[model samples]
Target: MMDKNQSKRFIQFAAECQSSALYEHLSLHIAEDPELLELSSYAQKGQPMPNLIFGAVHYLLLNGKEHSLKNFYPSLVNQPETEGVFTYFKDFCLAHREEIIPILERKLVQTNEVRRCAYLYPSFCYIYDKVKKPLALIEIGTSSGLQLLWDQFSYSYGTGITYGNPRGRVHITSEIKGDSTPLLLDTAPPVSVRIGVDLHVNDVSNPEDKQWLQALIWPEHHERRELFARASQCVQETPIQLIEGDGVALLSQLSDQISTDSLICVFHTHVANQIPKEAKKRLTETIQEIGSTRDIVHLYNNMNDGDLHLDYVHNGKTYNHTIGATEGRGRWFEWNIVD
Candidate 1:
């Protein structure tokens, strides 16, 4: 169990990983109140802390913790099922705060074991058959550009739903009801082109940021890191056009440049939740405007303030909708409008 001293140490270490402004921001909102800080102190000590807590901390650091705390954490800790995990963290924080804090910082910002399960291949395979011909792919939230390798490899799903090699980081295991499966193209189509955009892109080979990416990985799932490393290996050779600016702005630019003669697939994954409401609105509007004539495919979690589902429209009509889940795991429902 973590003691208060330990708790203090962890909080301080976490503070070090972030800038002063970030720490203060989180302290005001999410990490505010003695209990929350206490809980946080403990949570950092857990062997496999709840995803909710880890996600909360990540969000807090990125967004202001205090401003986002109430909305994000809510009363999740009080729930009966979460009591045990809560207690464990509380104790750990109370006991080993100092040791744990540095350890977590090291794990989060300096390791590679956390970079697994790049879930990009599965999503690509899902759309491969729809736009079978040669195409250019653009990805938003392209963290580390691992998905760019989609055009370079193949994947075999554990079940019957296998996709041939030259796979990307995403994978698909969930069953689909549709009669058609992804058709195999002669080749990945020369990437015609591929690019990635993110708020901050981790250099997989960079010692420091590599640790940060590793920290982002869930420790409980050992396979995730392995998968990410494997995908990373392929990405070294893949050509990725990385743009380091706002995705919404980029989409608007691409909307005008896309060639109708060729299919342009603009996609994303499990990243929408991190965007602010206003940003999301702009993104939706951008896509709605662009989808009128182009083929845009986005696979991202709808789990945000207003909606936890993704809505797609083609030619001003709804084409696809689904409740996006983490790591490409969950149910997907769609409605297509035939031209």
Candidate 2:
């Protein structure tokens, strides 16, 4: 079990890596403040404490909470106040202790980063190439299910060429790192069905849910905020089947519902880290069991390590490989798929 100080330090390093100066600075201060640390203790087990606390504060601010802390947020103000933010942040949290605690206790750090679709686009293409079947996407921890709509969005990997939906409303751009390039399809592969299962499925159409998701985005990430808004609009417009339950437990039952003609592509990104070790083992076993019957592909990361992995069972043979590494936010990815 990670203590409060360790969690705070983890967030501090993570924020620095993600280039969120605001969070990096705040986390440093929060680590030293016993009161704020105590308040953060309200977060649920396995939840990222920094994200929960910051998101709670952002949710309140977006809901029109009046506070000097608002001045420090780039998402709220044109010229955000840079200095003495910790004092204002501490004051705001203390003042709204009652309101913040409920959010901290209830909400999970479930960010549906649309940009992650950059890598998903190619991975799905690879699946389609191998099996030549429409994909049945079952996303575990699909908060708001925006990523399930990857086919409906356009993408660019720092190249002049455009891919995916040409007329896509949400155009995602990512940097292609490393020397090797993965397969890129001129168009998205056909998706037969999209099913998202989560402990608490967030409905993007709901005002409160939408606000909470928006709050999850870092205050300085203007591009991410805009992408989220666009993707949320897309999610509301699209029809996706969302189930409320433990995704790992429901995998087999859900797989039975999909037509055998479609390739079963079970996937989750940046979500498995929160799952219990035992549950993670069960999830892998379940996927293997499902694979024994028919062709299935599992695309995931943060299970054994942070690198993106592609494990597919094709024609009674199982092949597993590390596809490559990816940025936390999908800002860039290295496509190292060998043949």
Candidate 3:
């Protein structure tokens, strides 16, 4: 992230996060226009607003400006023909500069989509075996706790490989990267407890928050958009408890609260990338310190690994295991099982 050209770096990073014509057009548009470049320059703040370019477009779409970019966005319209049509888009964005600045100023893209659960197969598989029965799951960056109810959503990895609630409205599918897939249980584990900690817990029930969550999704991914809608409904039907605070700071106290009988497992997906390196160091140290008194399992999937990592405290040693490799959107995973 420490680059001389901040604006160029932000645009490149934002382009990678997106997969549709709207974003493609936006990238080309921002790269050429000085006004757009200046607007995107605000993202130099780093972790606070990592992807400011996308945030600006997402805010506009969520705030009833979908008409501005609907023709370019594929998910909203068929084929989405926007050939050489960046002037109007630029004008629309330029007009909404004041509205976008506030969204761009917000801290990070707090996404809580359940589609991410597709990457948790290995983590959950390990927990199901080691924990035996009931699991006390504590997620670090659990945004709205949608992924907290992972077991509730069904999944289809391939024609033969499938799991979770088959009748469930939300369905996520990942392409198999390799032959070595984890031996996942046909059914999800029995959850005795589920709680998540976040700096700002998003309530799916709230209109603005729910809309924001929807906005965070890329415009091309229609399946994910549908899955999100389904998951949001589940949020209203059965609400989850998400504590607000710094997870690394609040983890120890939260871990101590888990009952002795239940197996304590701390986990996070694509979260550590948002925090400082020192904070990540503190989180690991805190987890290991807490392990001294009780048995605890920690799992994390981040950009560094491209797979889920398991840290189990056994015989006073933290045995680390490389579980599996998955796509950014959980499109596929090549599971590497030690056992």
Best lDDT among the predictions, by candidate number: 2
Off by over 4 Å in 3: 1-4, 14-18, 48-50, 66-68, 314-317
TM-score per candidate, in order? 0.57, 0.96, 0.90
> Candidates' lDDT values, in order?
0.48, 0.90, 0.72
Best first by TM-score, ranked: 2, 3, 1
Lowest-sum lDDT 10-residue window in model 1? 108-117
Predicted candidate 2 versus true structure: per-residue lDDT over 93-178, tens digit per residue: 99999999999989988998999999999989887998999999999999899999999999998779999999889999999876
Residues 48-108 of candidate 1 have per-residue lDDT tens digits of 2223345334432333323222222322222223223434433434454454455443332
Tens digits of per-residue lDDT for model 3, 131-176:
5757778889888888888888778877776787777777778765
**lDDT over C-alpha atoms for residue 33 of model 3:** 68
In model 3, the clashing pairs are 175-331
User: What's the lDDT of the predicted structure labeled candidate 3?
Assistant: 0.72
Candidate 3 has what TM-score? 0.90
